[model samples]
Target: MAFESLASRLQSAFDKLRGRGKIDEQAVNEAMREVRLALLEADVNFKVVKDFVARVKERAIGQEVLKSLTPGQMVIKVVNEELTELMGGNVAKIAVAAKPPTVVMMVGLQGAGKTTTTGKLAKYLQKQNRKPLLVAGDIYRPAAIKQLQVLGEQVKAPVFTLGDQVSPVEIARQAIEHAKENHLDYVLIDTAGRLHIDEALMDELKQVREVAKPDEILLVVDAMTGQDAVNVAESFNQQLELTGVILTKLDGDTRGGAALSVKAVTGQPIKFAGMGEKLDSLEPFHPDRMASRILGMGDVLSLIEKAQEAVDTEKAKEMEKQMRQGEFTFDMFLDSMQQMRKLGPLEDILGMMPGMNKMKDLKVDEKQLGRVEAIVTSMTLKERANPDLLNASRRKRIAAGSGTSVQEVNRFIKQFEEMKKMMKQFSGMADKMQKKSKKKGFGLPFMGKSAGNLPLKERGPGFPFNFKPPFK
Candidate 1:
């Protein structure tokens, strides 16, 4: 949902120029005026906005081939490229020390989600088969230490705490020693946060840096802070010599100006994004993909990565075999739902799916999936594993247990039957598509989502259409 407003406005402005064979100065001027307003409304820095508009105008006006294609598309492409360049032309990877115990110090203001991100980074490292030690370095806030402890428990990472009596620098030193003694692969120090920039805080962080000698100093900033976030990044980077930034609260209603301006302002690559409060919500930053999403073009690679991360390949193969054999039942459906749930929010996952958002207007009854799950759960093991045995009495029992009427249960059964039929029909097509993808070297349909049908679902409850019409 980052840059939702800017995306909507820009898409609208470009919509009017789609089919134009020629573009004149007046038409280009009109589009630029709207774009200017959109950028300002998106809370972009005034100077950045001015420079962006000027560069865009210079290029657009000089391009004499405006008569060949709609000027709006050309402008959109230019804006996308400029935006990508503004955010950092390339993705930056976190620095991992060649030696063991790659230290990463997390620094940020209070309420910036630094402590949580520290735990997330530990988990991320652990996923890479690294033994990470979490050092609770926040001395002021007792809750901060406890939060780190809880996260350590969640990720099964060891936590080092000095019980608020010792200095953060002392705690960090002890933690590094502990990491060295235990042969830990990484040490993530969660440093204290201040309400604002202060000399005392900076000095304390500097001392911790000296003691820890972190390979990566990540400046955690709240993306919801807008331009203030960029300012904070600049201030922190100036003093701490930050290696990268972790933009937290990206799932919030952030205008995305900070995300777009941070690298340009502070010259630090955003190494990771805090998508949610969960431990697994952290994502590696990808500038080009983010630029595409901001332009309402969707991020296909991210979607595929997420699906691959979430889906169990062995389970998928089993399910595919079952579907091909026309043996997929309530158990398989429940297993599929559980697997999808591990991927996180339905909307976020679906949004990444190609063309899944195209049916937003049909109101793809997400609750129906929940209802189906509940109904299946209410069934006895025999009844659930064997759907054909769900007679009238069984249906009534399921409805009562699931807090629905018998009619709803029957409807769900019928829908499941339809799904089974569809799967049977899709089996051959899926195989053919799989072969085509192998030949083409790209994921086939349903491997990921497309952005073309955003605000629309590929298949909704009310609509029976098999094809998505061109949204634009």
Candidate 2:
């Protein structure tokens, strides 16, 4: 959503070159001109935009078009790769200290989402099974300490506070000792933030750094700051020796200039991105995925990787085999749903899909899936395994049992039948694809079907509209 305007502008620029078989120098120049304006409008740093456009032009001009591909797509691909390179090509992991109780000091300006990001980082580390202790090192604001405490409670991480009476350096030192005593693996010290750069703040941060001996000093910055965000990062890095940065408020209506500027200017990988206000909304920064999302091309690679992490491979293989044999049933579908549940919430799962984020107008009811789950739970084991055994009396009983109308039950059954049919067709296609992949060693990018053009009616009973390509 934050990248919507930029996505539209870039898409339009590329659309102009869509059908061109060969990208001539003139065409590339024209496209680059549009791209330049788009980036500027998106609040990108002037120098960064210039350099980015130059690299894209260098790769796009006179490049031979791929078979069955338009020049626009090729240019988009080049821009994506350049964007990825500019943002750090690979994912960066937080470094653990050689010693125990790895210290992480957070530095940022006021309203930069520093306190929230501190909590998100704690949640992230805790998810990795690390015992983290959050220290309220911000002595200036009472509300800041309370916010950290609330966040600490939310994350179920311990909060260390010395109240507003103590100096931040003393609090940080004591917090580190507490971390050592408790055998906490990580200590996150949330320090004070100023609205702007000031001498006193920098001096205070330096003092806290000396006391904490932080393994990593992460500068948390708001993505909405545009180019000024880069200046903040630079100033922080210059004084605090920041190891990395966390770009927060990325889910806000930001111009995306901060994200582009921070990494390129500071030469520090963006360690994480704050995608939403939820405590669990933070995600490890992925350059390629972000690039794809910006260009409106979708981030298929990250989506597949997320699926790999979420899905049970052995069960997936079994399901694949069953579908190939046209044996996919309601039971199999339920099992798959349960497996998906194991991967985290459905919303998070869908968010990682390539074009799913683009479906702003398509109101897909997530509650319907809950209803299906409820209906499935209401079914008996035999009914779940063999839907053919459900006669009229059984259907009526199931309808009553699920607290739904008989018509709803009938609709569910009809939808299940159609899903089974679709699964069989999909399986056949998948089998052919598997054979082709075995021969070629590179699988198709997608299912080889355009989900973008799917008819709304065929998208399942409760589905409101055709599925977008995935994270559009």
Candidate 3:
């Protein structure tokens, strides 16, 4: 929910033109006015907002839009393209050296998550079969080296530290040599940061940049800082000549001003975004996907990628076969929950699907899901494979074991039975579904309707714990 407020406002502005056959100048102007106010309210740079509005208005009011069969949709398309261009038109990839041991200097202010981001970058690189060595170059902050070392261990990357007793500049210089000796492909130098930019900090960073001769100098800025994030990027770019930017806290309760404003302000592409605190949460910044998300169009590619990463292909095929055979036991239910949890939060998954933003009012209590998993876990294997074994006393025992009331266990059992029946129906057309999709994507047992044929309880938006949406 990076641009929760801004996205809602923009969606509302375009609502007036939703069904209009012919988009007039008056309609476009009104929408632009709302867009302008929304961007300003989100703390976007004044100049960036003005220019963006101008560009969007120019295209929106043109004859081409007026001539389109679906002018309303055309106007939104123009805005989406403009928004994508305003934030770097494509993914800015990291620099690869002609020689191995590509050096990257991480520079930023304190609290911008420089250390955590470094670890994430290491993880991202390793996913691509690249060997990376993390350098503990932030000696000024107490325990900075220890923190990087811990992250290095977590990511399974080696941490190169010269100890706090040595200068960071020397540590960075030596880290490159160490990477060369170890045949590591990338050396990430986690440089020191300050509360604010100062001559001392800049000088130290410059020295590291000089000695390391980094292939990439990335400025990590906190996206929640709004305009201040842009200012920080500007300051760092002026001195360090950053090759790209890394935005942290983009997944937090941010207005998303920094993401929209930083590139336009500093003339730098955002290479990566820190989505969450998890080590695997750092993602390559995709401008078009981000623009689509802001407009509530969804990021289908990213969703598929997350699904593919989180799911085991072999296990997925087996699970689908079981579901098709009407053999979805409680054990399978627990396994599905574990796999879905690996795809980050359920809300984030919803945000990546078209029109799901409208269900913003719907909340998925992950803790409640955890409790459901606990209920399944508390069951004995025999009880899991055969629900009939769970008689009154057995249900009471399960309730006690899972730290819940008997009524709760009964409610879960009822929902699971409903879901199992639905899966049987789904199995009837399994071959047809398999033909349509390359393979079956992960399914939520009792969540999100698969289609009109799929049933949703009249009592609530979704069954089981009732993840109710605002709409009926």
Q: What is the TM-score of each candidate against the true structure?
A: 0.87, 0.74, 0.92
lDDT of 3 by residue, 1-472 (tens): 7787888889889988878988899989999999999999989999999999999999989999989999999999999999999999999999999999899999999989999999999999999999999999998899999999999999999999989889988898888999999999999999999998899999999998889999999999999999999999998999989999999989884478999999999999999999998999999999999999989899999998998998887886787567657576888877777787789988788788887786657666777787788899999999999998999999999999999899989988988887777666655555454454345452333322443333343111222222222232
The residue-by-residue lDDT of candidate 2 on 253-359, one tens digit each, is: 44688887777788888999887787877889998888888776676676576567667889877865666565756677777767766555555445456665555
* Clashes found in each candidate (C-alpha, N, C closer than 3 A): 13, 10, 0
**Which has the higher lDDT value, candidate number 1 or candidate number 3?**
3
- Report the backbone clash tally of model 2: 10
The model with the greatest lDDT is 3
Identify the leading candidate in terms of TM-score. 3
lDDT of each: 0.78, 0.78, 0.86
lDDT per residue (tens digit) for residues 1-472 in model 1: 5666776777677767656777777777788788889888877788778888887777777664374465667877877888888888788988879888789999999989899899899888877788999999998975888989999999999999878999988998889889999999989999999899999999999999998899999999989888899899999999999999999988774478788778877888999998877888899899888888777778889877777888899998787566645476788878877787777776665556443433334333556667767998999888877788988988998999998889988877887778767666656655665576566554433433432332333222211212121133
Q: Candidate 2 regions off by >4 Å?
A: 58-74, 126-129, 143-156, 181-183, 194-200, 224-228, 251-255, 277-280, 312-335, 338-409, 420-472
Candidate 2 versus the native: TM-score? Answer: 0.74
Off by over 4 Å in 1: 64-71, 353-367, 424-472
